[model samples]
Target: MLVHHLYSGGKDSSLAAWVLTRLGYEVELVTVTFGLLDNWRFARETAKRLGFKHRVLKLPVEVLESAVETAIRDGHPNNAIQFIHEKALEALASMPDVVRVSDGTRRDDRVPFLDLPKARSLEDRFNVAYIRPLLGLGYKTIRELTERLFIVEIRESEELQKADYEVELRHLLRERGIDPLEIFPKRHYQSRVLGWKSL
Candidate 1:
């Protein structure tokens, strides 16, 4: 029974794994490499530091680009990110050692996105858990938890460059003048896409 954490090698995702470990779940970190993530060292180091298993799932940049490009070609350019997240989830769920998939989604983040059920939709029929221990806690709180646990060192990223999807979407969001929340669907964070409650 391999428990997987939705790791982005960023503060939020890393914090999610940290919190879950304290809660007594057997957690491993999964880093979905989308773009030029020159190195996968962060996931490896963080997992080793926290004593959790880590794996890198390399998503083909071409296929990912094709999906987004197709959605754009179909006239829903703005929804590219939504498709990207969906793509990531589809790929993430296929791995063998993933009994549970956990993410760094937060309490403050839930109200807008209502992501609980979104996470659970990836669950396998075999009873895998999609966990989110930081569902109600904000970025600040997650950071606090990290600091309290003396894991702040994980936040330092030495990446040579940012992920392309991250850069492009942020630019689009800026151009649209919509908060990132607008891009996030306000859906449940579990198996059933029940309407979300702002926690």
Candidate 2:
């Protein structure tokens, strides 16, 4: 079966895609860009390095902005992130020849996660399966597996600004004279993968 893996060029997503590939699935990497400002260079480069077909899907800034606004209004980003992920899945499911959708979400992932109800709903709507290979793995396990499978260069989230979907939304909020920190929790650390060691 063909799997469209939601890739962010992070360790988790990269590992997830690698796992699917090992499982004998035809895997294609898909990265969602919120606006024109944040070019997904890292994601594209990682896909190239891994020898995977990659596609960049441009999502309207307004759509993500609306979700960010709602999350800020609600005082938590989980809902907003989940909304964006679901929307991404919907977009991928609509693509021709896509039989399955997958992501790098792990057992500990709070945001960008699909609850059972939502997963069931998506499967019913699209007649496709949603897979998360790392769902049962913890951070330590994922990190170990990543180190074993590929040599990766990791950068702090802030340093890799605009590499993540939330970064664009944060920038939008900041441009509008709002403080993203007020909405997002303090000391939230995310990472980006620069490149992987050649096998």
Give lDDT tens digits, candidate 1, residues 1-199: 4567656455566666656767877777776665444345655665565566777777777655664454445443335645665555567666665567666667765221325466555564435666667777766766565555543322111222222234344344444464434443333121111111232
For 1-199, candidate 2 gives per-residue lDDT tens digits of 8899988887889899989988999999998987656557678887888888998888877778788778778887778888888888998887778889999999998888888998999888998899999999999999888887776665444556324577776777778788887877777666566556555
What clash pairs does model 1 have? 106-135, 107-135, 107-136, 107-137, 115-189, 116-189, 116-190, 117-188, 117-189, 117-190
Candidate 1 off by > 4 Å? 35-37, 66-79, 110-117, 124-127, 150-199
Clashes of each: 10, 0
* Stretches of candidate 2 exceeding 4 Å from the true structure: none
Model 1 local distance difference test score:
0.54
Winning model by lDDT: 2
Candidate 1, TM-score vs. the true structure? 0.62
lDDT of each: 0.54, 0.81
